[model samples]
Target chain A: MTVLDEIETCIPALRRYAHALLRDREGAEDLVQDCLERAVARRTLWRGDGPVRAWLFRILLNRFRDVRRSAEGRAQLVPLDATVEPARSGGQEAHLDLREVHAAMGRLPFDQRAALLLVALEGMSLAEAARVLDIPEGTLTSRLARARETLRRMTGRAPAQDLVERK
Target chain B: MSDNLPIDDEALIRLRHGEPADREKLADLLAADPSLRERLAEWDRQDAALATLYNPLADEPVPARHQDLLAAAARAPGWRFRWPERIAAAMAFLAIGTVAGWFAALHQMPGPAEADLATEAMRAYATYSVEVLHPVEVPASAASHLESWLSKRVGRPITPPDLSGNGFRLLGGRVLPDSQGTAALMLYENDLGQRLALYVAPAPAGVETAFRFAQSGAAQGFWWVDNRLGCALVGDLPHDALRKLSLSAYDQIDQT
Candidate 1:
């Protein structure tokens, strides 16, 4: 596929990831736009061996970090409310009720959130996510575990204990 | 089963993925402790929920802001030259030599080499003007970011001249190293889509010139040196128009 086509295909995923990270629709869009422009401008930098999706996500992740860092340094941070999109908007399964899950996600450390998004929402393998995040796979595995455990604990709503009777 | 099963995520993920040994061992452990399977399945539900919440966003149309950015990127490079443009450039070169030679003589400036420096700036303008891709590294929409970026990169403070008053708005800028010092290339375009570039750099201790003009082929350039900064404004516009741009750029970029 052409670079533009590849980029277009990745846009939705990048937007989803960005929105999750920033929790502000406009801010997420702005961040993804910057990532797209930078990727296009630096297309030559990509060796073409890896999946374009992974590369784009990597760029998006790095841009988020840089912008977040500078914005934090400036102390002009706009507190991101997690209700930017109420999960029920899509008629998502009411059983899960994951808005609290998202709230817990927002409270996750950056690395843990990033690692979880790569492995969970994006369905990337541990190795692929480790490469994209520039972290060792062991670190990624640990972060994912921590993120999952924290979400479960904070939500206090996992159905695991009741699953035996339900089944 | 618990005696041999690893509790870490690595083993858990392996079991989920059906990696044989890990899955077999984890399955035996799961049979013994049904809660293990339930907990892993619960984690799956949570991840599934998160995905369902976010997947819908991808279906939304890309915003207008991003579409504009893509269009600008498509229009990024300014350096494609057609046969007609090349022919016109050849004709302009002759005209430039005459204008540049006479302009240099009129100045009767102390440094002969500085006149050549003006020609060098003109060359840089020529090199980048015909570019259809990757003209200036940064796009003009981020003018302040471009300014700070070029400034930090070139190790010189660069205040890109505002030419909107002269019917030109900045397209963007890039940095170059010249014999004198750090040189910056800032590109601008007028309403007619006509492009002009200002090449600015520090002048050597002895190299200095008043406003001078140069052309090679169709490109005409006007340049001057003040204190430490040497400035050149080049374009395919008329000699008078380019000259005015040079002087205007000088005023806007003057550090003092």
Candidate 2:
């Protein structure tokens, strides 16, 4: 496939991933568009050493981090209630609800959430996800384990017998 | 059957994703342990929940804007020359020569090498001031953060002078990549929407601190080297007005 075609195919996945990260549909789309423009403009920089998909994700993530840092400067402008996901309450539930899982995902640290999404939502392999995140595979694995453990606890899916281990 | 398993989290994660190299060993363990099976199922459920939440976004038709962008990019020639960026760069180089020559003629002194820094500022001002969308990487509203960030990158404590008294409010600032380490450009705008920029970079040690003036096209600049910092104050305003702002800006930035 041409580089543009490869990039085109990744757009939907990019949109999904951006939406998951930003939790704002319009903002996510804008971010994806910006990322696509950048990737195209700098297409010459894309060495055939890695999958174009990973490079695109890396660009999107870098853009996301820039937007986030700028957002941090104007923190008061963001409504606290709107951004904070409500913690899922109550004891162990037998099934995980999508909304609950999403809110729990939001509560995950950015690193952990990013790792989890690459592995789970995008179905990228551990090594591929690590490349996208620019982290060691062992670090990504640990983040995933921590993310799942946190998700289970927040969604009240932690096995009853496992409660004693919880501090 | 206990929560403890011989496999590490990495092996278990691989198994849950069905990429385990030792499938036979894991399968035997799963057969002996319902808990391990349950754990794998839980991972499956979590992935399913995430997929349910986000997959529809992918399934939805691609937005027109995205499709349009891809199409436009595809239509572009492989070896395209971006005229706007090229024009800006050419104008900058021209400004450098014009300013350097002016310093040589008007001052009766050999053109200071720092005049190039002045025109670099002019170039930055010309390029970014016309930018409607992203004139500055960090907006002026984040003044404190912008200051500290630029200061760290430029390797000099930079305080963007308050120019409100001179009918200009700070618009924002950005760190510029320079051949000599880095420079910081702080943009300011007047009520008429005219912009002025202050470019600051670390000067070479023992450099003369002579103040200088240079102009190119509609843009004029007043620049100087003081206390190991090279600074240029650039704008399209007339000579006297731009000179006035530059002196005060020099004073304010010099104190830092």
Candidate 3:
């Protein structure tokens, strides 16, 4: 398939990752739109040697950083932690509290959250996530481990088996 | 506090995320410490929770604005020349006032506010022209329906211009939100799938202007006001070609 078609297949995953990173629906969509525009505009610069999905992810991460830096410079940055609306009503809410999970995600550093979301939410391989973040695989691993620990501690959740028993 | 363990939390996390690991060591670690399995399962549950929270976003249809950006960019030249070329194009485009004086003596140049008609038209063209599943709210097959619906909504007697002579068949049209009340978008496509859009909206009566050209990247537009209606014809065709098509569309709309 053409590069555009491949990019098309990656949009849903990109949106999911963007939403996970920003924790804001409109911002995530706007970020995704900017990402797609850049991806298409620079379509020629992307060599087909690597997976286009990774390249797209790389573009998105870079764009997010640029936006964050500018927002920080302006002192108008809405803390990612502050912007997460509570989980909407009507979910199963059986075992783990998704709201707690989301809040904990917000509290994590951007790097850790990005690594965790790329691996767990987008299901990218560890190496792929590392490439997207332009970090070493070891760094990616530590970030994921730290993110998981922070999340567990912040959410104050027991082991999975314990949650099941409580349910 | 399993930092000293050869199979530490990082290793387990890596394994959970599908990184290749020393399986014999992991299995032995799991066997020696049953709690390791619990930790792995907890991480999996967190992942499950995340999926529950955000996966629905993936299933949501991508908004039309994004689709328009993709369509416009895809149609743009493969190698973008960046701002310099764009600025030069803008200068060249603005210089058309001299050409305008000769082309239509009676009409005035569109001021910045009035130029929104062209911008809106280009935006609508970028959006609807690339739609694969639903290009238009009403299809050309229902010609009369499209005409009457758009006419009534736009509060003008509107009809989709016949451009078959220009080798473009009427594809269909849709009503779009306009800053000045309602606007109508009629689409036409050639056999090669190249599409064009005509945007029509209400303008003050007793005012008329000749065609004014505007270019944004690959999309070119020629907008004019006549018969109390503001109209813009937008497409990705060559400048002269689109200009010709716009004049033809103008004559057809004028006659109707």
Candidate 4:
């Protein structure tokens, strides 16, 4: 497949991750669009040695951080913890307490939330996630640990698990 | 249950995978430790919940804005401003202005407020003009949803501004959030495949509406803030070519 086509396949995942992080569908779409613009703009800077999805994820994250920092220009603080509705699904999936999960997520610091989302939601390997976040694998592990602990404490339920997560 | 072995991330991973060796060890060490198994089940359920929450976005249709961004990046030489082409554009603008009175305004630099609106309009143009597949969230066919959704989000009544008289067709719009409340980006396309975007955001309270225009390397735009909204019309067409189109859109919005 062509590069743009490959990028399209990753778009949904990018949107999901962005929405989960930003908790705004429109903002997440804009974030994903910006990420696509940068990837297609600077595709040359990205070495093919690594996964393109990872690179796109990296850019989306950096752009998100840039917006966050600029918005926090020491004036009116934009609340990053806006209440979010988790993915809306029907039927058998109705049992999931998405609101509870979303509320728990709102309380997490950005780093831990990001780490947890990458590992659990996106199923990234520890090494891959570490590379994406520009942190060491050990640090990524500790972040996950802290995130899980925090979620457990806040939710008063079995913490969100990273099922089938790889090392 | 026997050994009170502490569970680390590594141990949890093994248990999650149900590695036979770990299972056998668990069988021997803590024969009835249902707690570990129960924890694993929670993790599985949470993972499933997240998968359900986020996995569906991929199925949602791709927007025209994203497709255009991808195509434009692929078509461009680079993301940097093309200075030589821009100089050529200046020459062309003068040539066109001599023939059509409207091009003269294209040469003027944008004021601060107009500059902000123009840049957003340019962004809207870059995001929607080149799209083919899904260029709109609510297509023109479903004008009511498009209208109501945009109106609600933008905190103002919005009728899809008409441009058929100017040869551009409505392709619908999406609401974008801003510091104040929200902004509406409505897209239009002429027969030649040139797309235009009409972006509407509320002006800071107390700002009155006026007819204003601005231009940049990417696209030239005309913007005004009525007592209720700050409106901009953007497209890749030269300013002279877009004047009639912009005016037509303004007229429709004025009625609104």
Candidate 5:
């Protein structure tokens, strides 16, 4: 199969990832479709050296960033539906509490969220993600650290502890 | 307690790496401090919620029309501004026409096969196009389910074409019969109103090695034989444009 054909198979996964990241179904699919078209048109120039999936993802993430940057002043959050129940039962009432978390996630600077999601959701290794994001590994680590801290504070979680215990 | 706390940046970096040993160390540190434990629990809750929010959206069905649109767009012709290439495309059509005439002269007694096949394909195309309420026996949105269902009916394993790159998404496929016998007609469309149909059947005896193109009124018909399968791509587009679409369809079907 041609590289174009191989890239076609990755669309569903790309769409899913984009949708999750954008939280808008139509916008996410459009981004993935556009990315696929760009990839296909550039297939001849593609070096076939790196993982195609990662390369496609990088294109997608970059497109998302561009859109986010251009629409900075116009960005609006979709209010979470209060009626939907949490997936799991917990005394903390994760469903109600999660709206705040989602908002906080949106509020995070794009680089931090991209780094955090690349690791936590997409399951990319730190090095792989750093390569995809075109940043130094140290930079990725710092972004992830800041992201977690921001999330912790937003969720009303206490600060990190200093106690140590031997394993 | 304060002295025992591992630095926040270090612990977070470790957690992102999925280092369980670091988590254990952090957990130990948090356990000694009530406020830190509470914070860690909150972070865990946030992760859980984020996962929940995104996971289900991935499984939701992409609208059928979007799949159709992508499929159609992929088949659209590439931009060409050069006169020589346009002339070459014209010559290709003339060559195909000449070949068709030669075949017609050789056969003398024309059978209804070509006409019948084109009509069947075009009819199936039109039927599916207007089908506002159930165009395909199996919708492409449930691709896995459609694969199994169409395969069972056709008595052969069939994989749907991946047209995402062409801007055409597989909306799924269905089995339809023509005057000739059982045929599989896969429906695909694009954001534009264009739609392409793939008509497949076992090749008739002795007629297993010919590539034929027929323009039926406004629609273009492409038929070819590869081993035992008779494949045709019928669509309402220019002949050269149709060939490119047929080639893509052939690539997709042949791979499957």
Candidate 6:
């Protein structure tokens, strides 16, 4: 496929990943736009060794980091209430539960959230996610475990007995 | 079945590798553990919500403006030209100069070199102009220091040209290398959010030049080579405004 076609195919996934990271629709779309532009500009430099999706994710992550770092002092956390919309299905309780999950996601440290999203949301293999994150596979597993624990506690869910049994 | 949890790192590896037996063991362990079930459920919900949250963006049409920007970038003169092709083309053209008609043909062909330079200059301007943090190597606030530093690097006694009369305040200056050689780029901006870039590089010996104007996309550029230096002024301003800026910059730099 042409570079532009490959980029177009990846946009949906990129948007999904960015939205999870930022928790704001506009912010996520803007980050995707920037990532696409950078990738298009540097297409000649792209070596086809790694999966293009992984490379695109790496670029999106880097751009997000740069934006966050530069906005560090002035950054404001988006309130959970602001992120939820009126449910088209009229299931207010389910919507509220979703909002709680999102807020819990926001409370986790960035790395853990990134790991969970890559594994659970994006369905990337542990090895591919590790490569995208520039971390060892073992580290990824441990982070995923910690993230799962934090998320369960935040959501008021019981600790999984598998974890206790393993310990 | 207690060992089904894959607690040992090796068993965990087997499970990750999608070994069927290990997968069943892991699933059974999660099924037997309430806490594990809750945690897994939470992860599943989070994933579902995220998938739904960003689904709209996929169908939301890519902006026509952004597509136009990409198209223009693709059509840019130097986009497909590798360094070797550029050098070879330059050499071939120069060699063809031995034939009278070929030399004239070479002179008549628009090289697009100036347009490429202008594009680079405007891109650099746009990138640095909007930055609230770390705008330039030297801020225009310290005009003297910026001038001296850039001048030392470019091997010219440079000064930030006074553009107060033209409503543009000197923003700052930086040194950038182009195909021609190392050049000095000075940035300027007005209150109206318009930015201008002036690039000066030493001219080859005895190459007398004339003022030339060219446009690329939204930007207009004016270029000339004086006895000592080749200079270009680039911006999105109208032709008259760009010409006026170029003249003002030339007058100031010449006096120095």
Q: Pick the candidate with the highest TM-score.
A: 2
Docking class of 4: incorrect
Which candidate, 3 or 5, has the higher lDDT?
A: 3
**Candidate 6 residues A8-77, lDDT tens each?**
6787678778888877778887888889877675554343556788878877886777677567579755
Given the true complex, what DockQ would model 3 score?
A: 0.26
Q: Please, what are the lDDT tens digits per residue for candidate 6 over residues B1-256?
A: 3554436433343354334575687688777666445434555665666566546665677666456645765566662425234333433443454433443454332245544555566666566656666656787766657877888877778876656446687778778876666778888788687888787876555553444665767777877665567677888888877866676676556545
Better model by lDDT: candidate 1 vs candidate 3:
3
Task: Give per-residue CA lDDT, model 2, range A34-125, as digits (tens).
Answer: 99987776664453557899989988997777677677857522322223432445343445887788878877777888889998999988
lDDT of 3 by residue, A43-103 (tens): 5444355799998998899778867755664755343443333332322234578788887
Top-scoring candidate (lDDT)? 3
Error of 5 at A136 (Å): 1.3
Q: Give me candidate 1's interface root-mean-square deviation.
A: 9.2
Task: Point out the worst 10-residue segment of candidate 5 chain A by lDDT.
Answer: A158-167
DockQ of each: 0.23, 0.30, 0.26, 0.15, 0.14, 0.15
lDDT of 5 by residue, B1-256 (tens): 6555455764556553645675677667666777656655565666677777676765666555445544554564754113224334434654566655544554433246644666677777777766767767777756667777766765556666544334354556788875555677777776575777777765455554334676766777787655445677777877776765665565445444
Q: Where does candidate 4 stray beyond 4 Å?
A: A74-96, A158-167, B1-4, B9-33, B77-256
Ranking by DockQ: 2, 3, 1, 6, 4, 5
| Model 6 bad stretches (over 4 Å) | A76-96, A160-167, B2-42, B73-77, B80-256
**Which candidate has the highest DockQ of all?**
2
Model 2 stretches with alpha carbons more than 4 Å out: A76-94, A162-167, B1-11, B14-25, B81-256
Residue B112 C-alpha lDDT in model 3: 57
lDDT per residue (tens digit) for residues A5-55 in model 5:
567666666776786677676898888877765555444333355677787
TM-score of 2: 0.55
The residue-level lDDT of candidate 2 at B88 comes to 38
Question: In model 3, where do residues sit more than 4 Å from their true spots?
Answer: A76-94, A158-167, B1-6, B18-33, B77-256
The CAPRI class of candidate 1 is incorrect
Tens digit per residue, CA lDDT, model 1, A45-111? 3435578898888888877876765666475644343433323222223346667777877877777
Between 1 and 5, whose lDDT is larger? 1
Reference A-B contact fraction recovered by candidate 1: 0.37
Q: TM-scores of all models?
A: 0.53, 0.55, 0.51, 0.48, 0.44, 0.49
